[model samples]
Target: MRFLSKKDVPFKEVVPDGYIDIHSHLLPGIDDGVKTIYQSGYILEQFENFGFKKVITTPHIMQDIWPNSSQTITSNLKKLKDVLVPLGITKIELRASAEYMMDDLFYERIKNNDILPLHQNYILVEMSTFAPPINLNEILFEIKLAGYIPILAHPERYSFYHDDLKKYDELKASGFLFQVNLLSISGYYGEQIKSFAKKMIDQGYIDFTGTDVHNYHQLEVLEKGFEFKIAKKITSLMKNNIEFS
Candidate 1:
C-alpha cells in the first residue's frame, strides 16, 4: 500500500488505520504538550479522525522540568476526559502514562513503585539527548528486577548514540525494547536522526512506533511521515504496539 503525506492528500488520510499510538504528550497544562483543555480535545479528536483505535498518552516526568507523579498524571487525565466527554469524542480510548527521564528522581520513583506504567508493566523511559546517564545499565537491571519492562523512547533521537549504533543492539540484548518516533522518518529532528531511524528499521531493531505528538505542528509532521518509505516498512513490524493496544 502507498502512503501519502498530509500535503499530498488529506491530513485525515495520512496514517494507516488501526494505529495504536503509545507515546504522546496530549494531557493539558502538564508537560511540553498542549497547554489547555481545548488543545487536548482537538488533538484527541484528530486522533479519532485519523483512524486510531487507542492512544496511550505519555506525559513527561522529568524531575527538574515537569516533576509529574502518577497522581498528577491521573488527575490531569481525568480532567481531559471530562472535557472530551462533553464534545462527544469517546470512541477512541485515551489512557495516561509517563515518559520517565532516567535521573536520580526516577530511580527513587522506581524504588517507591510510584510509576504510571503503560498497560501492565511497560515503563517508557528516555535519556538526555546530549549523553546517556551514568547508571543506565544499572537502572535497566533494576527495572527488570522490579518486574517492569523498560521501553526506551525514541532511541534514534539521542545524537550521542548515532555514531555507536551497536549500543542499540546492546540495549536490545539487555531486554530494553526500542520505540521509534514516527516523525523521525520524515527527518523532523534532522538528517542524522532520520538516518539512525532508518538504520534501526532496516536492522529490525524497532519494537514499536509512536507519534510523540507535542502539538498541532508536530502532528502535521507526523501526518507527512506516512509518505516516507520507512514509515510503511516500520508499520508492518510494530507488533509490540499492536499487542499492547
Candidate 2:
C-alpha cells in the first residue's frame, strides 16, 4: 500500500481565521484513527490550534472492509462528546458523519435509510481506486432518488480516473459534488494526485476541502502543506460554511 508521507508534502504560511474540515476518520477504536477518547481530545485541540472552527468528522462506513454501522459511529461519537465537555476548549465545533462506500451492499443499505447523512442529506462516498464501481451511475441515481445528495470524496485519488479527467466532469454533469482532500494537493498522497487536485481546482470543479486527518502523522504532513502558496490558497476555502445539517 502507498502511504502518503510528510517529506514530499509542503505547508502553508497563512491560515484563515476559520476552517471547516469535513473529512476525517476521528471515531476512535473503530477504523484507523484515534485509539481512545483521550487521543480524540488531542486531535480536536490540534484542529483548533490549526485555525479550524468546525470539524465534520467523517468515519468510514465501508461494510466489506471497515464494516461500520451508524450505531457504532453514533456510540463512539457520544463518547467523544462526553470526553470533550470538560476540556473547556469549545472553539472548535465537532460534528459526526460517515464516509460511505459505493457498492452493492451500500446501494441497498442506503435505500433502507441505514446510513448517517452528512451536511443536509449529503452522503460522502468513496469508490475503489482500483476500479470504478460497475454500477456507478445507477447507484448515484438511487442516492438522488432517496432524496440524498452525494459528494464524491477525493475523486482525484482514484487511479482509474487518472487517464480521463472528464470522468470527474461526468460526475459533476450528473449532479454529484466533489470534495477534495487538502493533503492530495499538498503531495501527501503523491505528486500525481497533487497535480490532479490543482487541475480540478483550475477547472473550477472542486466544491469543498477537507483535512482527511486520520492521525497525528497526517496532521503533521498537512501542517507542512499549509506552508505552500498553492495549497494554502485552496485550503483557505474550507471555512465556507458551518452549522450544517
Candidate 3:
C-alpha cells in the first residue's frame, strides 16, 4: 500500500487538541510582558481562541530589572485572573512561573529554594543574549544538585551559541533540557534565529516549545510562522508541553 501524502496545514488549524502553552509573558506589570491588566486579559483571550487549554506565563526575573518573586508573580496572576473572569475569558487555565536569568542572584535563589517551577521540579532558566555566564556549568551543576531540572529557555535566541553548535551538545550532555521559542521559529527575531531554531529541532535538541510571546505582534508572527512545513515538525514537541499541565 502507498503511504498517504502529508498536507501542509496551518499550525493553528492542526494545533493538538487541548494544546498547552508552557511559556509566555501574559502577566501584567511584572516584567516586559503585557504590562496592564487589560493587556493580560486580551492576550489570554487570544490564547484561548488560539486553542490553548492552559498557559504557564513565565515572567522575567532579572535582577534590578524585573526582580520578580513568587509573591509578586502569584499576586499579578491573581489580578489577571480577576480581570479575566470578569471579562469571561476563563476557558484557558493560567499559572505563574518565572524565567530566571542565570546570575549570582539566581544562584542564591537556588540555594534558598526560592523559585517558581513550570511544573514539579522543573525550573525555567535563561542566559543573557550577550554571553553565557562564566560559571554557567557551575550553575547547572548546582541546579541539578538542588533537585531542580534546569530547562534552558530559548537556546536558539542566544546568538552567542549559534556559531558554536557543539555548545548545544555540551549543554544537552550536561542534562539541561531545551525550550525553543516559537517566535524564534517564526522568524520574528530574525532569519538567523529562525534558522538555528529549525536546525536544533531537526537535531532533536529541543525538548519543548514555548511561545515566549511578549506582545500581540509576536503572537501574530508565531501563528503565521506555523503555516510553513517546518512548523509541522514542532507539533510533536508541542505535545511535550502538556507535561506542564
Candidate 4:
C-alpha cells in the first residue's frame, strides 16, 4: 500500500490540540515588548499563523526601565486587542502578564500586592546575567509566601552560575519553576549559554519554554528552533497549565 501524504492532513490536525504560549512580549511599548499597537496586532497575527490557541503576552516590570503597573499593561493589551478585533482575528485568544525582574522592586511589588501573575499563580522572574542577587533566596521565598509560583526565566543565560549549577538545583528544590529561552537552544545568546541550556535539558529541570520575543531579530532566531533536537522536545512538551493542571 502507498503511504499517505503529509499534505493531505489539515494544519489544525497536526498542531497540538491546544497551545498555551506562556511567554511572549505583545504589550505595546511597555518595557522591551512590542513598540505600538500595530506591532502587537502583528504579533497576534503571527500567533494565529502559528496555530497557537492561547497567547499570554508578558511584559517586563523592572525597576530601571519598565516601571510599569498592571493598569498600564491592561490598557495596552486592550489597545492591541482592539486593533485585532477589526481583523476579526478571533481564532487566537490573548492575555497579558508581567515578566518580573528579581530586584528590590519585586519585593516592593509583592508587599503592595501589585503583581500581574500568569496562569496557575505563576510569576515570571528574571535575574541579572553577570551577578547573582544578594537576596536571591529571600526574594524567591517572599514571592512564594505571597502565594505565587516563581519561575526563573532564561536561567542558562546567567553566567554567574557557570561554576556551580547548584544554584539552580537549590532554587528548584526550593520550588521554583524554570523557563528556558528557545533562542538560547539555537545558540542565540552564545556557545556557553547553549551549553548550559543543553545541560539543563539533560538534567530534566526545565519546565517551560518561551520565545521572549522582543523584536524581529529574536523571532528570526527562534524560528530556527524547529531544527534543533532540544527545541523539538520543548515544542512538543509545552502545554496549557502543565505545572498545576
- Look at candidate 4 and give me any clashing residue pairs: none
**lDDT values of the candidates?**
0.83, 0.78, 0.84, 0.75
Q: If the candidates were sorted by their lDDT against the true structure, best first, what order would they fall in? A: 3, 1, 2, 4
Per-residue lDDT of model 4, residues 1-245, tens digit only: 97643223332332354566777888877787678777677667766776777777789888988888899989988877777879768888888888888889888999788888887688888887778689987887788788888888888888878778787888899888898876677678878888888788888878887767887677655554433334345555565234422
- Each model's TM-score, in the order given? 0.92, 0.89, 0.93, 0.87
Q: List the candidate numbers ranked by TM-score, top first.
A: 3, 1, 2, 4
Off by over 4 Å in 4: 1-15, 240-245
**What's the C-alpha lDDT at position 179 in model 4?**
88
The CA lDDT at 7 in model 4 is 28
How high a TM-score does candidate 2 get? 0.89
| Least well predicted 10-residue stretch by lDDT in candidate 3 | 2-11
Q: For model 2, how big is the CA root-mean-square deviation?
A: 4.6
> Can you write out model 3's per-residue Cα lDDT over 121-140, one digit (the tens) per residue?
99999989998999988898
Q: Which ten residues in a row have the lowest lDDT in candidate 2?
A: 5-14
Off by over 4 Å in 2: 1-14, 241-245
Residue 131 of model 2, lDDT score? 92
Q: Who is ahead in lDDT, 2 or 3?
A: 3
